[model samples]
Target: MHVPDGFINAPVSVAAGVVAAGAVAVSLRGARKELDERAAPLAGLVAAFIFAVQMLNFPVAAGTSGHLLGGALAAILVGPYTGVLVIAVVLLMQGILFADGGLTALGVNITVMGVVTVVVAYALFRGLVLILPRTRRSVTVASFVAALVSVPASAAAFTLVYAIGGTTQVPLGKVLTAMVGVHTLIGIGEAAITMLTVGAVIAVRPDLVYGARGLTAPLKLRVNGELVDAAPARDFTPVAARSPKKVWIGGLVAALVLAGFVSFYASASPDGLEKVAADKGFDKNVEEHAAAGSPLADYGVEGIEAARLSGGLAGVIGVGATLAVGTGAFWLVRRRRTESAGAQV
Candidate 1:
């Protein structure tokens, strides 16, 4: 959920900002090891896809809707550190370009939606994969469960943040209850989308899926009454020999279709956080977004009378901008890794 301005006091917001900054710094260092040639470009496409899917809000309850928080999906497809950066890129773009999330609340949104979700989802996903049967289906199952839990985890994080810095005097128990309850319903949708997307990727190119790596159980052969380790797959292709361009192009096209056209049919109901805020009486103090006057504010192009065309154009622009920024960041990280290696020579 995108926390608007005035929802949290200035001191707490600034404190959260510091925490967000530190997390990003740490993630950037970690991402250096994760963003190789194969993953660098896909990471950007993942960000754009997340940005697009988030626009297609699905109905969760009466007058309430939910969309992909995307931490689990991104972490499953890419590495966790890169997943955090990808989500941060989307949040930053939304705040500055579309006026969707407030600039002042950027830290809150990133902390809850990006950092907390990615950490919790990846941790749970790894744990489950280790215990369950090592198969592609198991990976998808783990992804579903991880995504299901991540949404409520994010809601709980928001509750904790609000308890410390909520502008209104809403009771903590009520806020926690409502937030968790609504988000739990939202989690179902999140799990479904994550399972399908991760499953699809695993089916096509399991090699590209970060979470699915090493998931295949080692082969066993019967050798003279004793079991022995079988040789590795002979058909396996080297990473350097494979091109990610096909997957990248397919993913980009899917994202364009989802945001440019399918988004028009998304539910109009307010999302889980907005609904809870209104129900809990904290919505009254919400301030206008600082970038509300931007041409692309609220995912619509300025001077475009047709709702469909304006929204489509805004969505396309958002996808392009997010892809550009995310790719640049990941490419820089990859370059730094190379330079560091060269210096060790």
Candidate 2:
């Protein structure tokens, strides 16, 4: 859920902002190892894909809607550190361009939605992977469970933040119960999406799937009627790397179609956070977005009469911008990694 401004006081906002900044800094360093020339560009596409899917909010109970948080999906596909950066990019784009989230409350949104989800999902995902079979199916299964739980985990985090600095004193117990309960339903959707996306990618390119690394067991050879581990093949080239263009292009096309056309059909209801705020009476403190006057405010272009055209254009623009910015950021991170390796050599 994208939190609006004034929900939390300035003090808490600043504190969260600090926390978010620190998380980004840590991710920037950690991502160096997770990314290379191939993965860096793919990470950018992952962020843009998240931006597209988030627009497809589906109905949940209590008249609330839930959409993909995408932390688990990103961490499983890319890496945990890069996943945090991915969500941060999506949040920044939404806040600034579409005004989907409050600019002042940006830190709260990033911490709640980005860092918490990725950390929780990746931790649980890794744990699951360790216990399960070393197969592609197992990876998707882990993704499913981690993604499902991450929603309520994020909700619990938000509840804790609100308890600390909520402007309107909603009963803490009531808030916690409602937030966690509704988000549980949202978690189901998140799980399904993560599982499918991870499975699809792994099916085509397991090497590109970070979590699927080492999933392929050692090649077995028959020697004296007994199976033994085969020696490593030298000068091996991964077939997946050869078709980077296909994966990137296919992902971008899917994102464009989802955002440009499918978003119009998304459930037109308040999301989990908004529904909770209104029901609990804390939404009274909500303030108008500062970017309300922008042409792309509220996910619609200004002066566009047709709902379909305006929203479609806005979604397309958001996808394009997110892809460009996300790619640029990861490219820098990858470059730094290359420079470091050369220096060491």
Candidate 3:
């Protein structure tokens, strides 16, 4: 859930901002090991896709809705460090451009939605994959379960953060219950989206899936009375042969479609956090977004009168901007990695 301004006091907000900054710094270093020429562009696509999917909020309860948080999905597709950066980028863009999340609350949103979710989900996913069979189905199962757990984990994290810095006085028990309960429902939707998206990528290009890598069991051959490792294939496909551009282009098209068109049909209900705040009487302290005057505030173009067209254009613009920024960040990281390696020699 995107936390707005004034929900948390200035002291806590600034503390969270410092924590967020440190986490991003650490993640940037970690991402250097994760990103290479092959996966750098895909990381950008993952960010754009997450940005688009988040716009399509699905109904969770009668008046509550939730959308894909993208932590698990991004972690499975890319690596955990890159996943954090991807989500952080999305939150930054949404806060500054779309006014979907408040600029002052950017750190809170990134900490809860990006860092916590990615860490918890990736840990669970790695653990499950190690114990389960090394198959695509197992990977998908792990993705679902990890995503399911991540949402509630994020909710719990928010509860703890609020307990420390909530602007309004409220019963901690009720806040925890409502936050966890509503987010648990939201977790189902997150799991479904994560599972389907991870499954689809695994099916098409298992090589591109970061979580699925090293999952294929070594081939065994029965020779005489003992089993022996099978010989490597002589005519395997080369990395160059499987160009990422195709998948990149395809993913961009899908993101554009989801944000620019399908988003119009998404539920208009308040999301889990908004609903819980309103119910718990803490919503009154929420302040207006700093970027509320932006042309693309609330995901609508400034001059467009048609709701459909305005929203569509805003979505498209968001996708484009996210892609550009994300790709640039990842490419820079990749270049740094190359330069570092060369210097070692």
Candidate 4:
């Protein structure tokens, strides 16, 4: 959920900003280990994909809807550190470009949505995967459960933040219940999206899906009429290796299609957080976004008359920008990793 400005006071918001900055800093360092030549750009695609899917809000309750949070999905597809960075990038893009999230509350949104969700989901997912069978199915199942819980965990995190710096007076108990309850329904949708996305990637490119990395056993061969495990193939490339460009192209196209066209059919109802805030009367403190004058504010082009065309153009622009920024960020991280290794020699 994108927290708007004025929902939280200045002091706590600044505190959360510090926390968000620290999280991003740590993730940048951690991502160095995770991103390689192939994975660096793919992680960027994950961010763009998350941005596109988030534009398609599915109905969760009669008056409420929810979209993919992408914490578990990204963490499973990529890794936990990169997942945090991915969500943070998406939130940053949405805030500055689309004016979806408030600039003042950017830290709050990142803290709750990006940091909390990734940490909780990844930890739980790893635990589950460790306890369950080491198969693709287990990875998918763990993804489902991890994603489902991450949403509520985010709700609880926001609640805790609000408790400390809420701008308006509201019943904390009711707010917590409503936030958690609606988000629980939202979590189901999150679970399905995460499960299906992870399953699809694992099915085609288990080598690329970070969570499914070790699931595949070593190739077996008949040696002297006896079945034996083959030697580790260092240069043995998987399906994704045949053409990494194709996968990136396919992913970008899917993201472009979803955000450009499919989002038009998405539910118009308020999302889980907005619904809860309105119901609890805490929306009263909401302030106008600082970037409300941006050309792409509210996911629509400023001068485009047709709602469909304007929205589609904005979505396309968003995807392209996110891809560029995310890819560049990861590329630099990868470059540093390479440089570090070279310096060791």
Which parts of model 2 are misplaced by more than 4 Å?
217-236, 239-241
TM-score of each: 0.95, 0.94, 0.95, 0.94
The better-scoring model by lDDT among 2 and 4 is 2
Q: Measure candidate 1: CA RMSD.
A: 3.0
Cand. 3 Cα-lDDT: 0.92
Q: Per-residue lDDT for 43-85 in model 2, tens only?
A: 9999999999999999987678999999989988899999999
* Position 9, candidate 3: lDDT: 91
Q: Tens digit of lDDT per residue, candidate 3, span 1-345? A: 999998999999999999999899999999998997667879999999999999999998869999999999988899999999999999999999999887888899999999999999999999999999988889999999999999999999999999999999999899999999999999999999999999888777788899998776456899998999898767577853578887888899999999999999999999999999999998888898888999999999999999999999999999999999999999999899889999999
Assess the local accuracy of residue 43 in candidate 2 as a C-alpha lDDT between 0 and 100: 97
Candidate 2 lDDT score at position 189: 97
Model 3 spans > 4 angstroms off: 217-234
Clashing pairs in 1: none
**lDDT (0 to 1) per candidate:** 0.92, 0.92, 0.92, 0.91
Error of 2 at 305 (Å): 0.9
Residue 123, candidate 1: how far off, in angstroms? 0.5
Worst lDDT run of 10 residues, candidate 3, spans 232-241
